[model samples]
Target: MARVDRGAADVITSDGHHLAQYAAPLRRATVDDPVALPCVGDWAALTRLPEGRYELDAILPRRTAFVRGGVGRDSRGGLSGDSRGQVLAANVDVVFVAEPALHGSDFADLGRVERLLALAWESGARPVVLITKSDLVGEHLAGLLDDVAAAAPGVDLHAVCSVTGEGVEVVRNHLGGSRTAVILGASGAGKSTLVNALAGEEVMETQQVRASDGRGRHTTVHRELIPLSGGGLVIDTPGIRRVGLYEMSRGVDLVFADIEELAEECRFSDCAHESEPGCAVLEALESGELPERRLESWRKLQREAAWMARRTDARLQSEETRKWKVIHKSMRGRGRP
Candidate 1:
């Protein structure tokens, strides 16, 4: 469904037709499956219930899904101990990692962009670094773009001012040909404004950011897909608060591939990137060949991904043990009868 509101959803069909579908009940076992969840950009088979209403019969396998850890909770309503990956969007082709260029956050949020880029690369889709609110940047645009480009290697990066519509067309070109794009960023990053500009209308509500910190409120309450007039789809998501790693080792490798390759030239096989003898990474940093900031971002994400992997393994082990316990309990009950 394009817009999931309350218990109902606004479904869009193959030919751009719209239909209202009542929420479908999910099975207990399938409810916890991230792939089975009805997210924006999910392809599903529809069914006509006996009550003359439509329901999502099946959620087909997604080609590409963007998942993040820490969305699930423990029994006490706190964050879960294990890495519970919540799939944000499905069947996505491109991810727009938007960050605000205006305000003091332009260069300040490069680490955030790096973290999001790791997540985006792990989603099996392309990532585009979008610096929104470009007009507010003035002459610093070129410098800021250079910094962002260095942070995002082998990815498309652009500075787009949605209000003046500068560079918006270049952003839309990435969404052409019925491809699905997902807008991912923190609150007040001008995600909704860019969506409206791409749609050529005010398809989403936008609010001004706080003057003190330039942070925006949660204008988008949920993730919903909006079809663009120029073709393609975009799933607008609410501002993400926590972006803990989601078993994204491959993504981490890609984001830090430059460092990874550089490490191979070190003297020792197990050479850490620290102040070790003949460490290529450290040498590069000393010579200004590599930025210290980029290396720091790489190290942080690597550690986070490794920790999340251990947590994921523990969670799966617990789930397996619980499954066997339930199976044994059922067998005992049947034998007693």
Candidate 2:
């Protein structure tokens, strides 16, 4: 499927030659799990309804899926009570984490990049960090790149200027060979502009950011998969203001692999790394080997991932309990009859 809205979807034929817009509706079973519904990049089986409409019968097992917790927004601009995982894209091969090279006094939001990278790693896709608007930073570009690179170790990092076409080719190279990549970033990070650059045409609309605070208007409201002229596919999503983790302990560990490695040398197996004697992580922090900011970011993500895991477990247990209750109720009603 190239796009999904409500219960309908725009599906691309298996041969990749035809696109049927809003032609596929969800099968009853497919509606049980919201995250399992058709999403951009998902390969689905379609059934023809008697009413002459195509229904999304089933989705093929996804090689990778980009999911986040808390689908709705709360009053404080955080995730709402809805704890179900929301799948952004399915079967994605590359996750491009974009951030503006110049954001007020900061070159890029390293924390956001780290968070997105964790999600990308958890999605079973290769995560690449793209520092957009490199042209604006001038001589500071190298330093900015280094800072962001520090945040994303063992991940491909590129400082790209979509307007100037600088560093865009290298980023596009990963999308070759019929691979699918998804652009994830805050609004005004030049995701759409980057997509246009990679596509060699204005496939997506672009909007300028506000001058006062560098925030951008939401130009891409829906997630749509666009085929690149050079080959491969890209899913452009709306600017995400807040992205909550969804049962991502492995992802968090991968993101903080350096800390994980350091912790192995701790004297105790479960050292908290907080003033614990012989704690290599704390030692690295004190010795300037690990930045304090990075350590704090890792800790925050770990806590959040743990909390989300607990919530997911509770939700699943509750659902199972409800299922049994319904079954027992049905049996009781049958006996009475």
Candidate 3:
């Protein structure tokens, strides 16, 4: 076990190799205790224990953070949700949006791919598209790569097969020491298989896809940060079925940059780009320069982001009002008047 000096916890290994270090000296509340907290890809100052043990003391500053909203139950016990930002990973350089091969000669789900790309861009990390399971169905790799390139302009796309070990080196070449990357996709996308192949061992568990439907069950339950033997680190996350847009306005703008750039020529400064005369975005769509699907995706994400912001703002306002009421009650009791 290699003990890393992260400053706080002593690293100990039962198998004589360092895999994981204890997070904190004592169990503490996640909400109340803030310093000893740990997030994926965080470099911590740890304390080395006797016999090669380590514990985390403090988390160093992060270069980037990928956050998502936490879901909670509502008052009626159905699904009341508030936006609690949970950091998924930090300091990630690249985010791999892996997708499975489409079945029955149908092309892959481009819209889902675009959503993941938007989230990746919003994560403050460079996005890379990975189309997995190339070995199955004899799908041409170039066509998938081309589709991805068209869907996500200015992003790297790779066609990789974990089972055949094809196109894996290209992914490894980009990773090195201190570089972190995250793998994201739905269940049965072969993310765990890809992770195992990249690690050169069975570090993650993989499940076989159903023969009839071509869908697989979720195998990974928790998110983990694992160091690769080749040098860099990788964060493997649970299969995400849906990823909602959360305050990702800049990312949506970046995704539809062509439309945004053309909108400057609109007659009104706040043109909706819908039925507005002299709207350059609409003109481009009419001229066949811009795909209607791309514009629709942009509009959908923009509206979703705006709705998320409104919900978050409403929650904050409620909290603020409650705080003021408490303060007023305290002042009334003090009799300062």
Please provide TM-scores, in order, for all candidate models, with all chains considered together. Answer: 0.91, 0.93, 0.83
Q: lDDT of each structure?
A: 0.83, 0.87, 0.75
User: Which digits, one per residue and each the tens of the lDDT, describe model 2 over residues 46-119?
Assistant: 76667756666678899999998766777899856465788999999999999987745677888999999999
Rate residue 56 of model 2 by lDDT. 67
Q: After the best TM-score superposition of candidate 2, give how far the Cα of residue 121 lies from its true spot, in angstroms.
A: 0.2
Pairs of colliding residues, candidate 2:
none
- Kindly list the per-residue Cα lDDT of model 3 for residues 31-140, writing each as its tens digit: 43232246666665656678765555556777766766555678788754446556667778989989887676545778888888877788899988888887764746
Model 1 lDDT per residue over 147-177, tens place: 8888888999988889999999999999989
**What CA RMSD would you report for each candidate?**
2.6, 2.5, 4.5
Candidate 2: regions farther than 4 A off: 14-27, 30-32, 49-53, 73-81
Error of 1 at 274 (Å): 2.7
Using lDDT, rank the candidates from best to worst. Answer: 2, 1, 3
Candidate 1 lDDT score relative to the true structure: 0.83
